[model samples]
Target: MSLLNDPCATPAELADRCEEAGLDLAAAPTSSDLEAVGAFMAQWRRVVACSEHEPRAATLNALMLEYASAPWLTDHAGTGWHLHFREPDVDVPRQIAALISVGTALHLSGLGMDRLGICAAGECSKAYADISRNGRQRYCSTTCANREAVRRHRATRASATV
Candidate 1:
């Protein structure tokens, strides 16, 4: 979502964003890495915007096929044998893409594909993953919801006065 909202325009920015997102890169990002990350972000936007389950699943499957390798158990950093969905020694951008694609599939399948959405506020284009208990989230934040409510209230008053 961060990439969709504010895409990294350069290799340096991509490296920074990766670091910020808690990805430990084996080395600094390259131009190829930037291109790969940009492409993945575009695909991610499509996945989040899809309102139906089948299309979203298809997209995720394609992504996994292209970016992910066979799953493996690793304790690369002595972190106690966590599962990695990509092959060893993969580049940073490809690794992140694979992880995200697989994670999205799990999240959607477990939590319902409807949990992913773009905010309903007319002025906002933000994407959200609905983690709420009831899974009925519409707007991205309270501010947007409040703004929409105020607009509705004003419209009601105007209609009554007419």
Candidate 2:
């Protein structure tokens, strides 16, 4: 389980997290992978904006009322104490948005807003959560890192040749 904590999380799980964060980027996905990539960016933006702006409960309340429905409370199994933020019966979209709004607030306030970020690849635009020892992750994957290295090396060689 990624627990929404791991930075280098897998693509499949990333898709779920993206949806949970109110991202629906399947405008016309050529493939599932593209959809995943789009959703990841959307979720990343949401996390970044929330962290940077530090939205208040009232702001989230407005979003919930507009995009979602009135927030509700439901606890199942009662493992100690926790809140669901929305009724489980609510439609998936609203439920997801509500949770994303409130859950993101919790994550930013509890953790740190400087936790999320995009890949450092020259051309790639993937997102990450920076769970490193020094919290300095840059690239989305090893493939992107290699691609960037190749690009830089090729550019250097071309410049030398020129």
Best by TM-score: 1
Note the Cα lDDT for every prediction shown.
0.85, 0.53
Per-residue lDDT tens digits of candidate 2, residues 1-162? 132225324555545665565444232223444444444435435554343444544454555454444445543544434555665554434444565556555654565556555667867655565556665656777798788889999999999999
lDDT of 1 by residue, 33-95 (tens): 888888887888899898988988898899999988788898887758788888888887888
Best by lDDT: 1
Off by over 4 Å in 2: 1-74, 77-81, 153-162
In model 1, pairs of residues that clash are: none
Error of 2 at 49 (Å): 6.9
Model 1: how far residue 143 lies from native, Å: 2.1
Q: Give the worst 10-residue stretch by lDDT in candidate 1.
A: 18-27
